[model samples]
Target chain A: MSEEQNKQTLVAQETITAEVNSSDTIMDVFVRGARKGWKVAIDNIIPNVLMAYVCIKVLNVTGVLAWFGTAFAPVMAIWGLPGQAIMVILGALMSMGGAVGVAMSLFNDGTLNGTHISILMPAIYLLGSKIQYLGRLLGTAGVPGKHYPVLLGISFVNAAIAMFVMKIIAP
Target chain B: MEELKRKAVKVPISGYIALMIALVIFSGLMAKVGGGWTMLDFDTLNGKFGLMKSATASFMGQGGSGARDGFLFALSLAPGVMLALGLMEIVEHYGGLKAAQRLLTPILRPILGIPGICCVALVSSLQSTDAGAGMTKALRENKDITGNELLIFTAFQFTAGGIIGNYLASGSALFSYMTVPISVPLAVMLVMKLFGANMMRLYCKMFVQEEK
Candidate 1:
């Protein structure tokens, strides 16, 4: 009821309001971050897992991967990997998860060894997101049409170097 | 152009050194010196528990169901990847990335030959390649970074997209299967990716014409 008491009450209300606003901003940042994170994860994982499933089935049923492996065996030999690694490469071209799936199947069957998986892992990581990166991200990003080849070239070159390095040091 | 210009900042050399050191530590290259340090040692832990081994054995025993097993393996990595992406998004939201750009510009400018502003894209790419490329594309569209800068930065991302998160998930998976220390392979990958990026930067410098 006193003037001093009323003034104190007004000041306390303003302080609380300021504190709440600041905390809300921090909370908003975290909530927004979590939502975005989950969105990115789901977007990447679902397609990746699905594609891996399909690739594994196709590899299992068709045996085309084996044929391709035999065909690419010589080239793959240059990289110190077995013919079956073609499956991993093919899977990588589609998605990282697909590559992992293919690698796992090969590992289970005793077609690919630990060294081979080590050699392939980095290459897959480097080039695995190609579909999404090239088709959607780059296209929408307004990169010059001319630069696409250059970008692709970089990815392949990186993969190649990764393969070479991994082959030597994987053990 | 004004917006682009406004975003660019002169990063200090000390900041670059700090970043380089941080990167090395984060990549787990100095594991021996520190008696061992890594964000994920799932492989060793898995070995102790025999979790991954048993899982693989059971999956293999199913026979003709390789697809299902493979799908499950990939799905297993989802949690880590999603968490990484979410953390990155939060960092971006909080302007941590912008601050990093200011600090990392000088270093990136010299090594990758891109402007400092590209650090934002670089950091973004380290969380998710798509996010990085998308951000780079935005920078390019805004003329905040030049065409040459775009190419160089793209090369970097191409080699190591979502570096930390990607490696943590994929690398852990690899280690679980293989017998090597997880950090060794991860270090190898990071080095190779950086090598590829540097090679691309050199290529751009030697071949690509300046966009004056």
Candidate 2:
């Protein structure tokens, strides 16, 4: 390992040790974290679910999602996604793990498959680029600086390029 | 930012067109020029489209009801990650991370060429990529990050983890279909290297002031 990275690693190790010796026990840490996790999930998911409900109520009681699918189809088409995967993209982006729920739902209902999986790939890669407040916490916590605004742009372009190339190369 | 925005606005439209054309050419070549697959039935793209349409129609019909039963599959993992990270955060609050970063800050600054204060977003973005983008924006908003540094740091945030995770972990067929071939990690890393270097260079210009 490079000297710099090694130093960072050592520091991380020492910090953990020091923390354990303090008043907080490991169990205390875990409970706190779980509660925080639940909070983050509840906090983010509610707004999204509400938005989806509102969007569903206002946008297309009968075929709003289908229209959303169609609207996203061309964009998804660019990544080889069919129109139907739009909701899957939406589910995943609204909150963490929501997409997996969407995918699982589709899978059990005999909807998702290998081909659909392919179409969803680029969209997933492109999904949550706007994880807004999370980035600020990282900055405050001393994360490196070059990790936010541009990562999505670079990664998405790369993913788009990669996904397209894969489709072409495969068939 | 005003001047920089104005300069960015001046970039030629033709540049965008050229990029789009290149992408098309590359995609076409990928579609037709590949080997060891079904013997060149390009006209049957309609059949592929048809199959996708039928499958998707079925997928949307009752997918949501099934998903509610299985959301727990995801929750199982979130708790562990959150727990571990929370412990780490508590450790940080106690000043362990402060000592650690301080010890390593000098090297980090020279290598990443970023103010140490910006490292939080940079590192957070590294861990969770866009999960950290919000954090990055918050830092920017709080004025904890310098403008040029913010732009530069954001550029470095997604070398591979973001796209690859999206493609593989997010279970998005859209991403998989688009990315598995062009080498998402490679393309992203290349762009990151180039863009990040450029951002750093821009920040290092004679006019920019250092943080106090």
Candidate 3:
């Protein structure tokens, strides 16, 4: 074979070896992914879940939730929710899991019906995680200073739409 | 010369198009009718709560119901979140995410009014909005996306943070509340989110100046 052909063959062999060495097997990928996934779930989700549990427990036990719900009942009535749903909204403001916890409690006790859940779920899902989204996510994403208000406005609009649409569909 | 002169025929089927169609159809079906798998249940808890009511109504009363039920419901989400996130990680590790990013870029670019690379950020956002936002920020810092693009993207992320994980984790509670299938609300939320993002896109185009 010509010297040029020989050089090409050597280069090809080296490339193949490098590719093989660098590629992880499916099992390895799966294991690594699973580990990372669990870490994320634990780090991000578990705390929120725990927080929700605690928040609901405290609010219910103290009767503060009921009082707060009564105070906000008129506002909630506008959205077809029980005054107690104020807890869910408050919980959502704090964390997504907290909102879920509140919702679960209310749903289980027959405080908030399916229609209420439908209206609240989309609103909470869309608007929850406020601190993380506003402080960390958008703040870090380098959004322009001028756009902040606009973005906030859009968030409210989305929440409003979710609430209205879900109310119509579920109610 | 003859081979070079031969015309290339356009085929209707493409892998990406097919996948997109399948996803839409599947989501529609799931939304209209409930998913087959019943991943979480409150029946046992209901029975237990009934027994508790009869036996120790005064001792362990309604005061703790919120905490007790909330804790159990949160626990119920664990399995689904673990599985969904774990599978996402595996797909990401296998270059499936990258391939998806590439395939989705062109399609998303015109609709979202952003570069194709934004698809990666969008997909990542589906699992964890924070991570997705962080990734988009990195992309912005690296000059992979513009500020206006960031605004539009953030609009989407903000509206529907952690789409799949959120759905799976919270769907049970939502399902119990609404007689409608979980997918129906999910689909509705997604559409509203997309609409919100596009609205931002239009706003940016009309009002905001392009970053130099």
* Best-to-worst lDDT order: 3, 1, 2
- DockQ metric for all predictions: 0.22, 0.14, 0.27
Model 3 chain A weakest 10-residue run by lDDT: A12-21
Better-scoring candidate (TM-score), 1 or 2: 1
Docking class of 1: incorrect
Leading candidate by TM-score: 1
Off by over 4 Å in 3: A1-42, B1-70, B86-103, B170-177
Model 1 misses residue A158 by how many Å? 1.5
Model 3: lDDT of residue B135: 62
TM-score of 2: 0.46
Worst ten in a row by lDDT for model 2 chain B: B41-50
Assess the local accuracy of residue A32 in candidate 1 as a C-alpha lDDT between 0 and 100.
Answer: 58
Where model 2 places Cα greater than 4 Å from the true spot, the runs are A1-21, A46-61, A67-75, A88-110, A114-171, B1-117, B124-146, B156-212
What is candidate 3's CAPRI-style docking category based on DockQ? Answer: acceptable
- All candidates' lDDT scores? 0.62, 0.44, 0.63
Q: Order of all candidates by DockQ, from best down to worst?
A: 3, 1, 2
TM-score of each prediction: 0.72, 0.46, 0.71
Docking class of predicted structure 2 = incorrect
Model 1 clash pairs are A37-B86, B126-B162
